[model samples]
Target: MTQNIIRWAQMDDIHDLAYVYSESYRKAYVGIIPDEFLDQVSLNERDQYFRKSLSEDKQKIAIMSLDEKAIGLLIFDFQGEADLPENSAEILAIYLMKDYWGSGFGKLFLNWGMDRINELGYANVFLGF
Candidate 1:
């Protein structure tokens, strides 16, 4: 499979980002949450909120494809300052486009983010099942 290189999201990606935002979201959180609740969600809101979070969350990141495609993303940690004295962390979300699920991008992106976290002084990272 061709490797899709990941890069930090930019303003030009809002549209594709929104598409992947909803698509991957429908696959990941739709069933766990409720349909009506899911229907009420706004990708724009999530984008805006996460944009600010990314700007501020030094421990957090949002990545996309080099060709403006958003196949998947990995966001780690919370809203407040990280208190992990040992630098243990949580991978809040790491979702792939449904078509790319077993295509190796998942593993590639996961390890990429783990490497980032470790470079940021983290000893461990946790991903939600």
Candidate 2:
């Protein structure tokens, strides 16, 4: 089995991260979200968003790679809802390339994110999707 690495995302990973996000969104949300909206998605826009995310101190955005190719993206933040516990963490999003789906990478990524959140002193962690 190929090894997978989960690491913090960098500026250079913006394009690959965008591609993974766009393709995964298109595949996963086909019937749920409007096709027109998905069609209008742009890699450049996603790249910009990720660029900003990388600079945010509160947000934790990470990339998962298998054999040196980026296959997924994960975003989490300590910003919690009012009703939630203090110092709570929320998993804003997690997306993987369709080809990697059901290959246990998702579980691996979730565990990795949870570990990081715990290390950051969060009292609770919730997954948004």
Maximum-lDDT candidate = 2
* TM-score (C-alpha, index-matched) for candidate 2: 0.91
Candidate 1 lDDT trough over 10 residues, lowest sum: 78-87
lDDT of 1 by residue, 83-109 (tens): 544447788777788887787788888
TM-score of 1: 0.75
Candidate 2 per-residue lDDT over residues 1-129, each given as its tens digit = 877789988888889888998889899999999999999778888887888877665677899999989999998887777877888999989999999899889999999998998888898888776
**Top model by TM-score, which number?**
2
How far out, in Å, is residue 115 in model 1? 1.3
Scored against the true structure, residue 128 in model 1 reaches a CA lDDT of 48
lDDT for model 1, please.
0.69
Task: Flag clash pairs in model 2.
Answer: none
lDDT of 2 at 51: 80
